[model samples]
Target: MTFLRDLLGIPGASSDPAALAAAARDRSGADPDGLPLAVVRAEDIDGVRETLRLAHAHHVPVVPRGAGTGLAGGALAGTGAVVLDVSAMDRIVEIDPVDELAVVEPGVLTATLDAAAAEHGLRYAPDPASAAISTIGGNIATNAGGMRCVKYGVTREAVLGLDVVLADGTLVSTGRRTVKGVSGLDLTALFVGSEGTLGVIVGASLRLRALPERTLTAAAGYDDVASAARACGDLARARRDPAMLELLDGLTLDVIDRAQGTDHGRRSRALVIAQADGPAADAEIAAIAEVLGKEASWVEQGVDAASSDALLAARRLALPSIERFGKALIEDICVPRSRLADAFAAVEEIAAEHRVAIYSFAHAGDGNLHPIIGYSGEARPAGVQRAADAIFRLALDLGGTVTGEHGVGLLKRDWLAREVGPDVLGLHASVKAALDPRGILNPGKAL
Candidate 1:
């Protein structure tokens, strides 16, 4: 592998041991046994093409990485591989307001593209929590869903087309600039969630929507997790479509209050935040307030726009706030909307049984719960694993998936077969085999 980098002559490629080690892990927090031989920060399409071509020739494994913000260890370099870093390819090729599309390079941050689109009275709807730091390429790789997903959609929904570099350095483009096209197999969608195991995404053409003219938000406090969840179910049944609806358990609220030194301390066991966007915001929020009022202990009807933004900002800070209290392991599981209440109940039982401090929050509108266990106690890993296993099993039993948005990277690989069954898993393997016969493109990830 020493001569691999030299033979490629790829610009900005590095063999620094520290860089190699850094490239080995992502936000997944799991350290690999070994690191890649080199890290190549590709500046453009040519750089990516050459890097992959040389690695393909040598049969050296290639791991494509963006901002390394993935919660799954999809980008972790376990064996002797070459890490192709594309963060330097940050560029916005075009933003066509008439066509409602934004052409961008792989490294452009999600928030950056949104900001650029904002100038044209347009917005990219997939607002992941890590929007400020996570690159578009990474979001596409994971098919990431976020707060707005309940109303808008996920990364794959926003993606209209993609320019991908295959394992053998073959550049193939899929999808089209037009919104409605059924030309062939949706290869663009296929690559969107493949987590780089199929091909490396070099460019993306994203569909955009006009920015909402008005926004309204509502909040409610529940006496128990079940009540809060029922309120979410009520909102789901209502005709109104809110841009985002979130939940924060009492403990998570306490952590946020402690971290920020605020006066949010209340007796409610859970807090529900809901928002609606567009010209009919007032009516939609009025409807949401009605549903929540039925089950909430106390309700704040139609908070001011500024207050709404503040409430959302606070919701976004849930993970970091809890991390300040203790060692936190965040689990992402989404159950059926009706089973959300049961799911929370199970997590509570598991936490009490295992004697672990578990705090939770969710995109309750979508039945996605992030149960964060904060523990700084004895044998933390064992306790965390047990609690996680219980929570995930409960989700699966409720007819939910192991991952809602996060890909089946190393962290969730163990349970994927069980969720999808052997036949479905075999199909995934077949697809992987057809696209990546060498198994060099992000080996040991996704499928």
Candidate 2:
């Protein structure tokens, strides 16, 4: 403890019970094996390097953390480990409209970056629901995707370069500021979704987009979730490139209705929300509404900005609204666009078979579903685990990954091998070993 304080300065390190308890868990609902020894709040890149240097020398495990809004248990710290907190490093170093990039610290809030970009007539396209609170470092660690991902892609797509601290506390810069570069091994892409196992991200240069000239939103309601999912596929097949496309199941709509005092569920069992931006925004949404109307019970097109926000609220409020029912174990599974309907059907069957309450929503255009399993009590119900397992298996069966946006933290570690096969899994092990021979950086998580 004294050594850590000396390395990071007194204000940067703490062994306080409250700090340890807060750092011990994330929003994943998985309890930490035990509390961390201490929480070191690193305010700068030098502080991060110093803490890692000490941890490497002492052979102590370190868990690099951002805002703690991660859906997977990637940031959870356990006994004998040090929680390296970087949320205090929030700073937007520069926003270059000429180069269409933003240089930022790892701790900068996702929304803050977008807002700053907006001031320069640009926008940050990745918008995970947690963007309002989630940090860029955490997004990069998990390679998070949001509603806008259907068009702009995920965090990896926005990142132009990174300043990473390796396992041995060696600071290395990978990637470039230009739009395209393939100089070497492409280590930047490798570390983007590594879940902090190989290294800790300290700073990033992010790509930005010009603000759209116009924007429009449209929504449709269906009698069943499968129909709504199919509508998403239909829009994709028709080559309608929407900036955002979201789907909410009946149970999810009900929960949101109760929480927000809206009547979305009463109107239909399912809802599909779509947003189009740029020069042809109006024409694109009209086409989207027409395609949705083929299978939809009701369709609302060209909605006013306020009404569009009201419609989009269902997706933004999904996880929190479901949590109101009870503790929610949110599961992320993505399937091929052609099989989204089949995947949703399997989720319904799994929920019924296990007798658990599962409310699902999706970034439908991308086939990423978030099926939240709600339960009561201090201990997670066995049926909840069963239902979640069944969901993961079905996703694999449908040729989809177990996780779409969220990284395979402690919760999804067991199913990773089954999805990637032994050969690829061995490759993962090889990579981990080469990068972190001592295995002190975020051990026993992503791999």
Off-target runs (Cα >4 Å) in candidate 1 are 1-8, 377-380
Model 2, 1-447: lDDT tens digits are 656566446358888889999999998888898889888999788888888888888888999999998888999999989999999999999999999999999999999999999999999999988899999999999999999999999999999999999988899999999999989988999999999999999999999999998778889999999899989999988998898989999999899999889899999999999999898888888998999899999998655678778667778888878777678787899999889889888899999999999898888988898888999887999999999999999999999999999999888888998999899999999999998888988888989
Best by TM-score: 2
Output the TM-score of candidate 2: 0.97
Task: Encode model 1's per-residue lDDT on 1-447: one tens digit a residue.
Answer: 445746447887887888888888998777887877889999899899888888887788888999999887888886678899999999999999999999999999999999999999999999888999999999999999999999898899999999999998899999999999999899998999999999999999999999998888888888887899888988877755878999888888888888988645465778899999998898888888899989888887555777777766668778888887767776789998888888888888999999888898899888889888887744457878899888878888999988888778888887887899899999999998898788789887777
lDDT of 1 at 154: 88
Range of the 10 consecutive residues with the lowest summed lDDT in candidate 1 = 1-10
Residue-level lDDT for 16 in candidate 2: 83
Structure candidate 1, residue pairs in collision:
none
Worst-scoring 10-residue span by lDDT in model 2: 2-11
RMSD of each: 1.6, 1.4
TM-score of each: 0.97, 0.97
- Report the Cα lDDT for residue 165, model 2: 96
